[model samples]
Target: MPRWPYLLCFLLICGLAQAQSLYLHSPQGPLRGGVNEALGVGYFLGIPYAQAERWKAPLPASGWTAVREARYFGNACPQRGVFTTRLGGYLPPQSEDCLNLNVWMPLAAPPAGGWSVMVWIHGGSFTGGGSGEPVYDGSRLAAGGAVVVSLNYRLGPLGWLTLPALQAEDPQGSVGNYGLLDQLEALRWVQRNIRAFGGNPQNVTVFGQSAGGMSVCDLLASPKSGGLIHKAIVMSGGCTFVRKLEEDFTFGAEWAQAMGCPGADLACLRQVPLSQMYPPEGSVLANVVQRVEAGGFERSPWKPHLDGAVLDKVPLQALKEGRAAGIPLLAGGTQQELWGELLSAPGDWTSFEVRAEKVLAGKGKAARALYQRLYPERPREAWAYFQTERTLLCPSLEAARVQGEWALSYGYLVSYRSSVFPDLGSFHGIELPLLFGTQNTWPAQAIFLSAQAYEDSLPISRELQRRWLEFARVGEPGWLPYDSGKLLEMGSELKITDNPYQERCGLFR
Candidate 1:
């Protein structure tokens, strides 16, 4: 027994040394990455945290006896137009097994305390984004003093597919929300192995914009996601896109039936070519029901569903009932023209006005009157711009109110009129470049919204980054929790302002 104990101790020491060693096995073949001193970070990209059989749900990665090559980005999950290479520049490639994540650890050998963790979920309307986006480089955030991570999860049809048969066949008996499941799995990965990367498994903040923000809301409301994260930062989209279980499930079933299999037929759905499963278009679908699914409330196109497993209820209800985990939450929306550029390509201003009315009606009459008074001189083209507040800003502000009393709730209004489109004022998606502080990388319309030539917004970007870094380390972003009386304004200036209470925005409370 004494001899066996000695042997065990010797083996444990060897394994520890081997576990700390790093290597690479990229598809392009072997390569090496090392620790950076200036950035004070070490990054290992393309680490696999989960796996899936072809056309099947993701499974825990096969355990390996040896240290794994976490060096290369695995092939991205298959879906329609997930190919970011077409989004213009800096997009990598795509694939069917893209279950991977990237890590950024402090450059130092060992810090006194485990580094704080910030896991960013990239947003591309839930259909077309990945961790591979260049702007998502984790080194900057990690070097700023936390273990920053960005990851890839299944997206689009491959993710939210819901069918009765799939549910029937479910090992967990849950339907739809596979992409969300993938996120939960990633969080599980962080909880289980992040200590190896110098991250405190217990402390984490999940942050994202647009669809990623929507995902954050889903997770926040999900029972399955209860203790995985300590805080959340929701950028643009949140609590807006709601779905029904039957509608999504029925749609999945019809698609399967059209493929010659009928009745709760998940087997057939899984076998179909992914492209055939989810057709692609050069557009982002809003919460509006489609012409096909419009007839019934049950049919929603490619969004999270009201399945009882992961998401038990919608965000607003969950918040009111106090089902939320009560984690500190920081959420905000960009100022005017939020969805303008995205909607401009094909639609007319009248159609845009119709969208505005729908969003306002949902917000309430008080918001409508206040919005009209604020934008009394609304230009024909600018109609869409004002709608941004109704559709996004006010809604998010109200959500901040809910968390303000119980948890630290900080809100900011992105009001710096973009230097690029100084004429248009601040526009939609303006927060992206600003948050990443990558103003130099703007595209055509995005360029118009840049703060480049103008010197005023420079300090704002720096300050915002500082606050974000502070949030990454400590829960508060160094501001008073937004309250009914005072709200934080994140513009060319940061100050307290009266909450917008006289409009549809009031319905949120």
Candidate 2:
């Protein structure tokens, strides 16, 4: 036996294990990808799903003859560093040509048709976030007997800007939903290419957290998104308040004036740099909230609005009217939501009242009185619960209730708290670590849990992943529909609970 032959065999085996190359013809074009034999998964990274023309609807990915490399992650859609930094810097370099998607599939080939598919839409309030974030790695989820896909869409002013000049450019006179159109384009891409990656396009599940979750609701409501997605899991995103493209130009006018552009000057607006679209230095969060309080729906000039074309009505209204896509829904929220901020001083009833009054606004007197009556001596707990119930819990319950009229809707309240940041409770987005199974990662540790806490959360994380994957596989996570407005509280223990803020929600209703 020749040593040369032995060396050649070793090299081949090593190549197969380290970077097993795979080539496939997809609807867009032939793509090249790598496989992780150790994990028993195949990875196709940074494949362009669509192309965008600034603020216009996205076009399908251009076909290619040569095998396009999908080894590295795609460029993140252009957004301010401040936003990503606030999120603990999980996003990648920004680019306008960032409408890319990634795929993960089991090493084994699909059976008759294909494996069930889970498409992820990252959330950053419709202004930030991309598919390339480290937490969104789909390998672990894909390894569990499914194919997973994550995609990027436009954000901020580039994605959601509305102007008469831009609308004039549109033959259909529809604008302001370019980011949503990007999502639709990605789903269409999945229908075309996912089968090649061992995924069943017919049984697709669209899942996302925060703004991504809101996107899921929008997809469910929009007539255009019908049949593109089969099931939806909306985490930490509410559907109660939907805004219209209000004729009042408080934001649009201010933004245009700041950019030295007229309300109708699309070209002039386009020339303004990406950095200019962000709020003034160190005031992103405050400015955004202030603007939103001032009657704008977004911190930036971007956010989903009831565009007559893509979104004809509010999602809740659509669901009520049975105009939304009749798809199974799993809507959930965290136990704390913005409760962490309120819990810092337990006995500060004055601060609590002030904050509570501000949060309740028009209904402040009623909410304050009800909250004070419910937990008179426990202002801290009351404030925390008030934050959770009003923003996350009640909205989710209400959304589920409306969805029940047209589809099977399940509601969950994540109450698992972190041993590291115990006060944080099940704060907003706490489920990301558990859901992504990234509790051990440095980013997750820094923001979400301590090492010990992460270890402690492993079981819950695994269970959460299992439940989500199960739901993706079969439109149910072994839970009953929330027809009666009962929800599963996912905490140290799982039990059914009536809407926590049914009375408070009644005020809104």
Candidate 3:
């Protein structure tokens, strides 16, 4: 009955157990992995799918002569240690040589067509995330009968830097979007090599949360990325946002000035050490930037911008015009995001109306009236809920509406509030552990679950994983498409409901 037993059992199963060796030969070379007997899964860790130089597209991994040991995770992309991934543990030393991926294969024999593959792209504002986090450990998912993958790409200025000088120097005339290129390269690797790991490359499903989810959206609209991602799931991913290459280059110019180099000096910029590009921690600028990115409220400087080659135009516009890849899409967000509490700031009727007016801007009157009508007494809660609708939920609805018109599409709202951080509501990235079925493995329990909700959360976790795996296996996740303007609200009662905030969303549109 005690929780300690469950905790200890999970630790014993996931860690400290001596692993059995497993081997597989692929295009790259023979890879050596470790088997978790308890989970009946084999893990191939930290395998490089490509090699990438700074400010350049990734190249295929070099040929290997010997059996490479893939028993440990590769380096995470260079990033500040501001955001805590998964358990908030110490990360492995960051590196530029971080274009690696991890794979998990079921020990059980595959079916006739091979197991379905799900590639996970992590979220850290495109500046701080790696595939090595424990919460993303794929052994459990593999055991549930699928091939799982997580990968690391370039991050920060290295991943998305744009400069007129660099563009001029490049033969391809492409600048920025290296991180996205790394993802494409990884998918190509999967197409070439996943068959060796008992995975059907043709049945691949790409899914990610937050920034990674935004990458999925980009891929949807990118002609270069077509046929690679068969099915897609975008979790906590916002839509209707993109930047021009010129706009992004301005940030590069600022970065150049900060580094004491001329904005147009490509050679000088390349010569600067990675450490000096971004402050690691403790600096005022770095702290402010980290806070804003972490808030999940605004676009961070380090993100995939509209490079002419990779992305011809904004994804939303592409989707609207039916230029998007038109694959099956599952996109939605949490019930409450980082702006919820701030939007819910204590205020009188007049102040609440003022704040609503400022937030809604052009569409102020209707949304504010709806908020007042919905939560007459709880003005703060109403405003907070409205903030989520305006920024995340409604945009996601628009995405679903657009995709559903042409392709099989599903939408969900993770309405299960965290018992731990009740004030934060469902919060961003909260669905990750649930989807991975690793909520208990989170090192910081307070951030994920409360003592009272620990046991109660397991069923929810299981259901979420089941639905996601279902979606990966087939295009459908046991839910109807949002064609009827109904979304599956994932909470204590998982059922179809009319999509929320229709009136407010209409005003925004």
Candidate 4:
């Protein structure tokens, strides 16, 4: 054969292979994905899993007949953007029609059985955040032998508002948990469609951080999510925290009044412009302070509540009553979750003492004395530690204790501080970059890690990914369960510790 003819044949073969790698036949229809040539991972972005009208349950997405090109991210659910160091200080385009998901898988053929699946739910206090956050790119994790999926659910009032009128509109009488319902629908979509993308439908691990973690716990408790979730990971979110539906009704009434619909009028409220829904920044902070001062640190109007239909009881109560009995759970928080807050507050020893006395009121002087003894010199560190324990760590421990009694549970504490911003310590969500292997690349994380720091942290990142992938594949993260009263600590060194801070947590309990 002629040399030119041979060259043309080779090019044709290469093109066919590339085309085949980017195509998959999902249950809904055919999909064409984009490939990350560098990593050899195929990513299908903005795949609509379900759709819903305002304040109603999500329905399966309408089917399409043609090949759908999932090459770009869908619109972010409507939200008022907030700049944060963790989210890289930007937001994507927003819209009400944002019930879409993104998936990443290795281009190579699946192993026997199929690749394990991990579904990520991003957190923005249940108000903001979408699946398209750069830090959440799942290509790296998918390349490591698991299918990674990230999704967007409804947010803010559009997702979680509860009122008597809205309840009446729902046939099942479910209200105030539309965001959570959206997640359940997404899982159902996975069960019906993931196998087409080379994933094992029977082995799905739903993992999330913050608000997303809380959703994981809710899923574990929801009867609707029984077969959809096989394993779960909750990061920096407590299982026990949720609002009563009655509380939401009261808040809804007040919100309605604020929005010029004094009777909680559904039609009027629905007509209210989206721009008017977002409260002023100052008002939000004030509301948070009021809730904290009233000792409802975990309660928020926008968070999931115990709606009778969607959630028959408080999530923690259900868990204690064996709602998530057989589901293996890995739960933990960063060691310095609230340490960044201290940077904006007074750091004097006297201020710390005063704050402790006020916060520990009624607990007695003995408790205060013990706390002081625990951190005699570092006043700011002591206060930050106190908040971290009360708000996140202790609640996590309580949830782990209940889960440990019923099924396999493991706990961890991330104590690694970023070398680029050592002052922040292991602040909230510091583990995200390492878990996604984006520390040196994503701008939000790269700003906090120098070239040397990224290199040094590579081993820790790899180890974290390994454990998570192992947990998704099987049911365990390779450490003794929380039933053993030991948790694996990750930092510069990884070792098992006997559940640190229990004594201080006991003071609050």
Candidate 5:
């Protein structure tokens, strides 16, 4: 159980095991992955679980006789618009059949108890990002006494083209929501087969950031996802938008019509190339889903629909109605995410003033007027507070409030900052490395070579693991349960803070 030396040896062997045998029993055939000394673990990367019919809904993978070569990553599902993707500037091949998951397991399964498993869902407004990103390297977290799983979900048009035309088709007949389905299938695979890799299926904690955080909230709201996962942690944010059934049926129909699909019908939609499906630039909804879109596939919009099963009702309602799976919850956002999301923007009011005005208009003229009066000059703090409400702070508190009615829920704010990205505020998604203790294997391997970086974050990583693993093992994450009245602020120093945030947060009220 000694920590530092235990992982020290593994970090030394990262490149040596790149070709390790990784064949395992997936519903598909056997798959392969590489191993790394830096992680001191065995890994299986990019294993597919399901397939889709061009623009049609996703289908379960076809069973096979021999194992599949899961070594190199399968193609990333097609996405659209240039944004924060996994590979970013790198353009690898793309495809329609991109439902893959990655696994990192301890070389040793820790005697008989095995290891706690944490499945990570990458965030890109549910449109971009992949399992292959170096930022998500699981070696660090796995080395911290757990198995780690990260997966790629369909984003944008390829993943969520819900339209009435597609719904009229056969087989319980629906269109869109491919991303959520892909997650359900991946979790199912983990439940059935993770033990072979030394992970405890029943002790699984589903964790994610941003859109991934939205997915976590939805999964908690899902009956199908219940029992499959025992604990949940959400970072960055949670779900706010839920699609009406009629709205779901028509969004894609409109897009398909715009695409020149025959009468906005399913047949024509089923024929359009997945790549060309994103809404054109300057479109109204496109702006809403912009931050979520990535690559060239287009339309990585993140909203849960009434899928009839799996996700029967929208998450906000389900949680309030006490319909979601009652599991332990750990949730929160950063201290300041306004300037964080738009990190490149200046720290002054002029940079964010216009944007603030436009955003407040969405809240209605009176509210806009009220907001402008209070925040007219747009001090740098106003914009930053705006992001905290929409992204991390408000959603985290709301999710805990809703879920706490039925389950044990602990809330927090990751007030820590990366010494690396100094100007980016505490920022969105910065905690990714902190959560996994992978600061060394970050944006570049050069970071790990720096002794100061390792020294600063290793203890932080251990502290996070202590809280995270404890939650995975039991239910509470070693903090006071969150409620409207009182919540815990977890940091280098811990304290009970109320509302966790307000003013800008109170705007939502």
Candidate 6:
């Protein structure tokens, strides 16, 4: 056979495949999407899901008559700071008109009903991050016989600011929770339109990390999210952590006053420049943290809050009362949530004991005895483990236990240390790249993992994807539920162990 003939045939097949995956008819309109030939996935990026004005509820995206090109990502919601710039490199153009989402679906024939849908929400403390981040690319996950969707909701002050003036304007007097409302609207968009993209609207799973995880819990609790979400995966986010809208009113007033709009004058506040929204010397997060400390509340104020109309009760309370019954829930965090800064320096058993004594002040002696008993010999690691349990692991487990009472709930703990950054052992967010199979796209992988380490982690990555896909498909992640008193532990080895940290967590309770 002539080599030229073979080459010509290959080109013809490639052209036909490209044409076949290029266009699709959506309920909203005709869309032109791009395809990853190598991955055999069709991607529709930057599709507008809704439209909203600052401090207002999102409205359905206007239908488009012409074919819209969804080849590039949409604008990220307005955000600033090192978290947005240095860490994720999400330097896309910013805008308030950013209620858009991206979708990736397998090009192959759909399963019996339709492909299971997984919606991703990125996390940056509710102030930064967007669906456009490179690490969030859904091609690999979508390639695993699923439809993957990621969205951009409002962030920072623009997304959450609440004031009396704003409340009075709302018919229900709703305040704060605007960002959460954006998420709800996105889910509604999915239900109305996902089937057009070869997804099962009834089998949707919402998953997120950090602040995004927190949003998942919020959605699970909201009556507005009823029937829109079937399964939820909350990573490193506790269920019970939310404040009342009234609590944020004071902060909002102060912020407005600081911006020269005393009394939260809506007219004047609306006129403030975007640059002034997040001043360079101090950030909205810093200001909120200061107020949070002054108000004596332990939870971060930047996240979603209970606006009476949007959320009737605290998420955990709602779960305990069976408001979210029958919804399968998967929730957990890393083994060491805040390892880098806490364990950055060298320390010995004596040093750890001294630090523990100071921190435990009133109960120093008893605390020391308990610590010694729980984590003997490895004194320095004890502090990191305790902090992790208190901040991420225990809270997550507590939520799972409560959820298990009315639903099939699972808990997980990721203890897989990176070979390159061994000292940062299973630090916060280590599971993301592994689950998405986006190790090559993750910024941390470039900085930390060598090519060989990336290769070695492939099996683990694939396993995570399989487990998560199975959960989305059949509401089981190939393990027993949390009520069984066992939780899956993912690390160098994978196993289901009797719940760890019961005694340690009890101390906090």
For candidate 3, the 10 contiguous residues with the lowest summed lDDT are 1-10
Residues 1-509 of candidate 5: C-alpha lDDT, one tens digit per residue: 43444244344333234456544554455555666656666778777666766545556666678756655666766665334343243323567767777788777535344578899987766656676666676776787678888877777666766666555663665445668878887888788767656677778899888778888888878776767778888886665644556654545545565667746766676677653565456766455434333322112234556767546776767778976547778888877655544445436554454565465555544434544566676545555566567556786667876788888887777666545555656666666766776565535333335577567767766777778777876777766787645655544444567754645555554
In candidate 1, what residue range of length 10 has the lowest lDDT sum? Answer: 283-292
Clashes of 5: 18
Q: What C-alpha root-mean-square deviation, in Å, does candidate 4 show against the real structure?
A: 5.7
Give the per-residue lDDT digits (tens) of candidate 2, residues 164-198: 66667887777778888999999999988776676
Give the 10-residue window scoring lowest on summed lDDT in candidate 4: 1-10
lDDT of each: 0.64, 0.75, 0.77, 0.80, 0.65, 0.80
TM-score of 5: 0.80
The segments of candidate 2 whose C-alpha lies over 4 angstroms from its true place after superposition are 1-20, 82-84, 247-250, 278-301, 343-362, 447-451, 493-501
| Clashing pairs for predicted structure model 4, backbone only | none
Q: Model 5, residue 103: what's the lDDT?
A: 83
| Cα lDDT tens digits for candidate 3, 408-500 | 998888887777666667777777777786776645356555666767677887777778888889889887787767788877646678876
On residues 238-355, what C-alpha lDDT tens digit does candidate 6 reach at each position? 7766778777788888878777788888889778877777655366754753553343224446667788878888887888898889989998999888775365422655565566
TM-score of each: 0.81, 0.88, 0.90, 0.90, 0.80, 0.89
Q: lDDT tens digits, residues 427-468, model 4? A: 888888889987754555554556788787889888899999
- List candidate 6 stretches off by more than 4 Å: 1-21, 82-84, 281-299, 341-368, 377-380
Mark the 10 consecutive residues where model 5 has the least summed lDDT. 292-301
Name model 1 segments beyond 4 Å from true: 1-38, 54-57, 65-72, 82-87, 109-111, 257-264, 278-300, 337-368, 379-382, 423-425, 440-458, 493-504, 507-509
Better of 1 and 6 by lDDT: 6
Output the better candidate (2/3) by TM-score: 3
Candidate 1's TM-score reads 0.81
Q: How many angstroms is residue 38 displaced in model 1 relative to the true structure, after the best TM-score fit?
A: 4.3
